[model samples]
Target: MTTTPEILRYAAFTDLPTGGNPAGVVLDASGLDDAAMQRIAAEVDFAETAFVTGRDGDAYALRYFSPIAEVPFCGHATVATAVALAERSATGALRFATPVGPIEIVTTRGADGITAAFTSVDTDLAEFDAPTLERTLDLLGLDAGALSSVLPPRLAFAGNWHPVLVVDDARAFDGFAFDPAEARAFMDEQGWPATITVLHPIASADAGGPRRFEARNVFPVGRIAEDPATGSAAAAVGGYLRAIGAVVPPALVVIEQGRHVGRPGELVVEIPPSGGITVSGRAVPIPDDVG
Candidate 1:
């Protein structure tokens, strides 16, 4: 008899099934080595893939791998994996022991299925020097004016390090373009693990309520030109918002991404009064098999 690994695909951040970031999940990757896991992730060809091994009570030990390498943490993939587990077990709270640290996830079952949300580790922000920022902009083919003064240039981290460059509006985001090779080269020079550039409009009052913000993420280090939905980046943004005092305590913000890729994703970020950030979304299974 032969054994096979179960590979499941789930789109995080969207309940509509069509919209969200797609992640590969291996619920039981007990015997796989690092190289094997990397190969599996590469074969799946999603931005990130998650592999799980042990579970202690409600907590499980998990690892994340990109198509090219292993990442310390991945927020969207975490949410996807949790929801996948909830569908099998029962919808409720689960814990994940990741490379970064232990994370808590809560799941709920609706008419559609189980939806999961994960709270990120404590976040921090740092300032980058001028030369590095200039070099980065040069590689991105963007001028200093293209950057938004409101957000400024900062290195933000929740689990992984991402240099966040915020732009003024959707037009700027839509108009911006860059060579992947050049961007990668700049990141290599700057010693940045990953670089994410986001463009957002100022908050506006609407008839319904406060309008949800629209944004796009450009990820060059993962060998991806752009990510459909980026929960890690969203967590970093939430931390940034808190650091800058943009939003008061106990605020909920919506981040819209992947619209340009035709796979629109929505991420809801909640900031607690005490601390930490919670990112919530849905995951849909992808039909595939792995071992």
Candidate 2:
């Protein structure tokens, strides 16, 4: 690389810098190549880092890289990038050309902070075969009985595919464990670099509000054992719920994650009748000391 890129640290999905998923953002990655971006991401040592490689008017081209590999899409990092851009520019609509497809994000500055919402690409779902389901359950230290009867085992895709495992009992959900190496190998085999998303239904904080869920994303391929907040996985969760008819159309789904890692955050998912799901959350700049 000719020069060092300016990397901004931001925590997505929460107002507090220390209370969300931290991601590295390179707003101007003009001269950086893939190798340089990957090296920078590794140096940053976050779960994911976003690079703005190209720009046209209000639209930008973005690439996401984890420490170990390139990812097609990363929700938290996208939010971080969007917020970073909004802070420098204006709060409004922005388009990102990603590996998967084009993503539309809207930034709004509120009293609390700068909140950015991105509508996911077209979503799809696939059920797990018997053998695959059995193997996954085994690796996760869970049995078929522990799974929620409401949401079956399936692969949900928003930008990337993720295994959606919803446990009926919250206790079982919290109690399940797995070997990261084994899980990572299995995920690699399945062509899923994304997290194995585990969700447990929880009571909504507001009466008669959106459906609430507590989430734990297992991804041991990188620096983190568990993601504090997984925006892409949360988007896939919205698709899974909508596809499975778990929630009514035009519903709102609330996902609370990161408490396990002590970085509690919330993601607001808006499900329309038939289209991309919108995941919204605020991002805050991470202090240099926290980096």
Candidate 3:
């Protein structure tokens, strides 16, 4: 408790230090209390900071805190923490005891870097409420006509709840703009951390292609305006696609996020026939001077 904890910085979902979402990892948070953790997270000032409270055998108790408050779960932070742990320990399967549930993480080291895959908890998919949808459209300055015909709006949950919204126009999706304050209010009302907004440019609504999709995640609830890469949201989207029969079993989809903010990163999602969804991406240690 007397010693200063090392806040190692790592970028999740991308090998480049400048790309992907930056997360602060406190490998050992043994003596830190809730207030201390919150203060450290605020000082780090990333989208999310992960603290490893203790380790019981190979399982570690983990918690996520943002600048403002604590969140139930975080996708990118889990991957980053797993990679950080793998770098120090043996690179293999690891379990994390989160507030939501125990998350299984499998990490591997290669020439590219450390790659971590997280298996999500049980997923739930339902039509997103109409009132929330309307409020979101108004806040984003868009109408129902802007929505994609093939991909309907649905509320999806894996570790955290995220409303999946699909847009038709690529140009409009690329130029996404939303009021942060309005989004924060909406998120507070719904108790959601973020909304998954995506655009699939394929002319046909066909399945089985070069698995990739463009996405922008707005996370006002977590006190982050926008996230560069969101693994939980990506996992929810994968489950949503599967639930709607848009994708076949054993599918692999690459999610591209954080383009507008210039921190572009890719997250690979794998959907099994009938089980939990898996999200995979690489993480590289960020330098002390990196923004």
Candidate 4:
């Protein structure tokens, strides 16, 4: 008997139902096979959909799928799934066995709403060679001069890989254009990162406050111009900053994203001295009527 799994919708990185990235969450997907999950994701047509296939005690086996294919991990979907689970059960610590590895998540409820913070798998980073950087810039319709000297381009990984490009001028960063098909091909040729994150430094920590940035995460293959809130990309950014000696360990960075898409959202990143980065956000259930 083929039973239909219930699909829950949530917007991650923002408590507001209208803001943030929307994701589909299947709390009980044990009966669904990989093909069925992919079909469900395609039908949902969100940036990503998460399926909870198995559970033992507090730990759950998770799989992430985009509208097109399966992904190793997804941060926004993780937050949405965690918040969904917390609402059903209790708010506290939970473990997820993801394709990458085990991810630890802590859920807490405050006066406002439920919030979830997920610690990513071990993070790694590498600088882009000159030719590769040039090709990347060209594909994005960006020039070398637009690149920020403080935070150069690099490939960062925390569960999934992302190319972090810090732009010196916010205007140029916002205005650059590229063909989706071309960009997707280039990305596929260059290792298929989950997203290409372009950031503009809003405020520096040396200026007497927490380091802040505004970001636009591009994932052309997903058929979306920009992702509203990218938790995995934010985690990768933390790794990039730490590995490049841009931030002192044990720092908190605020990333403001999705403004360009008109669905503004925020992601908080915590960087420790070593290991994986932690990305925190709140997710709210998106009413079925909204979609």
Listed in order, each prediction's TM-score against the native is 0.91, 0.97, 0.94, 0.97
Cα lDDT of model 1 by residue, 7-115, tens digit:
8888888875567888999999987888889988998888899999777666799999888778889988999999888888899889999998899999999887777
- Which pairs of residues have clashing backbones in candidate 4? none
Task: Please give, for residues 151-215, the per-residue lDDT of candidate 4 as tens digits.
Answer: 87899999888988999887798898888888878887988658989999999998897899999
- The lDDT ranking, best first, is 4, 2, 3, 1
Error of 3 at 135 (Å): 0.6
Collision count of model 4: 0
Candidate 2, residues 1-291, lDDT tens digits: the string is 398879999999998988989999999899998999999999998999999998756679999999899999999999999999999989999999999989999999988879999999988999988888898889989878988886788999999999999898877888888888898899899899789998998864366877899999988856678889999999999899889988887889999999988999999999887878899999999999985
lDDT of each: 0.79, 0.91, 0.85, 0.91
Model 3 whole-model lDDT (C-alpha atoms): 0.85
In candidate 1, position 75 carries an lDDT of 88
- Candidate 4 error regions (>4 Å): 56-58
Query: After superposing candidate 3, which stretches have Cα over 4 Å from the reference?
Result: 202-209, 221-223
lDDT at position 47, candidate 1: 85
Model 3 Cα lDDT, one tens digit per residue, 1-291: 367588999999998999999999999999899999999999888889999999867799999998888988888999999999999988999999998898999999888888999999978898866887888777777768878898898888888888888887876676668878777777777888645455554333255464678888887634468889998898898898899988888888888888877899998899998767999999999997888
The segments of candidate 1 whose C-alpha lies over 4 angstroms from its true place after superposition are 56-58, 205-211, 221-223, 287-291
Ranked by lDDT, the better of candidates 1 and 3 is 3
**Cα deviation of 5 in candidate 1 (Å)?**
0.8
The candidate with the higher TM-score, 2 or 3, is 2
Q: Report the C-alpha displacement of residue 163, candidate 3, in angstroms.
A: 0.7
